[model samples]
Target: MIDRSQLQTVLESDFLERSFPVFNSPGIKDEDVMIHSLGCSVWNTLGHELGFMAVVEGPAPIASGNDIRSDSVWFDKADNTPLVLIEFERYDGTDRGYGKLEEKLGNLMEASMRWGDQPTLLVLSAWSPGLVSAPDFERLELMFRRGFSNSKGAKIPAPTNCQLLLHRLVLSESHTGLLQLQRMNFRWS
Candidate 1:
């Protein structure tokens, strides 16, 4: 098992190189490609037959609820009006998070292109590595591990900007993992 520092480094690095495409075109059926891609059949990098991605509609916004929060995130309240909001879910109780993140990232990039303002806020919600042991955890954990160091002579302030939340739930035969997540809110000004 990788240590916390190594995991953080891997995740941070991936995030830095990662870019989300935002698409904003009139009459465009797939206004949100990444979001729509959820449950859509696609090919993985290794050329494997993928399953349908899951998509979630406008998630109910409520303050003070299980796995919920109200914060100025993932939107440009300064100039760009409320154009759109994207909420990701982790289906299969894995790191995939309702939909494939790659598509969502692509969609974010598309949105950025159409909109004049750069992303101001970012909000990411997903289970953590140590808790979920998700398939994606290895990647994120690798990122985090390599980026940050508990050893002597390490840099301060990691690359990624996000917060983690832990939710304790009853364990079952099928589900035996802690609920961990990281939320990021993106916006433009």
Candidate 2:
């Protein structure tokens, strides 16, 4: 099973590259573009170490066998199985707009539900301009928990293994450094 720290350490270098443009200035960013960029970065940084090839906006595994898409998926090179699944979103403000996030979480839930038993990471990365407040973070966690349990016949999440990783990416505070990347901790609770 892949540990949270391992994934966290790999993505630490990506925080700046991923969060800068959106946080530095006032303009809208494209979620698809960000997902593609993340795919390149993840594969370049972790492909060899994990033997997984990252794909962007690829077909997801679902019971219905429909053409559902996932923002990012890392496939096991040896077995061609999806080992990491992610859904990315860029919310307008720190507060509100959780409905969009909930939809993304639902997407992640669907992809994870069909994945075979293995060491997998179901990720939801929601980028915000500024840091999310305590109440907002609480709501995010609650939404994930609710959705996770409702998926029937899904892999039971274990703290050390398969779990929904909810990440909040926000701009760094002035003291930390102007327009820098800041991230919050995540794992199924």
Compare the candidates by lDDT and give the number of the best one: 2
lDDT of 2 by residue, 129-172 (tens): 56654335566566555544433444433223456677665645
TM for every model, in the order presented, reads 0.28, 0.64
Give lDDT tens digits, candidate 1, residues 1-189. 112333234333433123211111111122234322421211111011111121233222332222222111233234433222232333245444533433333333233223332332222233222234333434433333234322233332222322222111111221323221222222211
Pick out the ten consecutive residues of candidate 2 with the lowest summed lDDT. Answer: 150-159
Q: lDDT for every model?
A: 0.27, 0.58
Question: Candidate 1, after superposition: displacement of residue 158 in Å?
Answer: 19
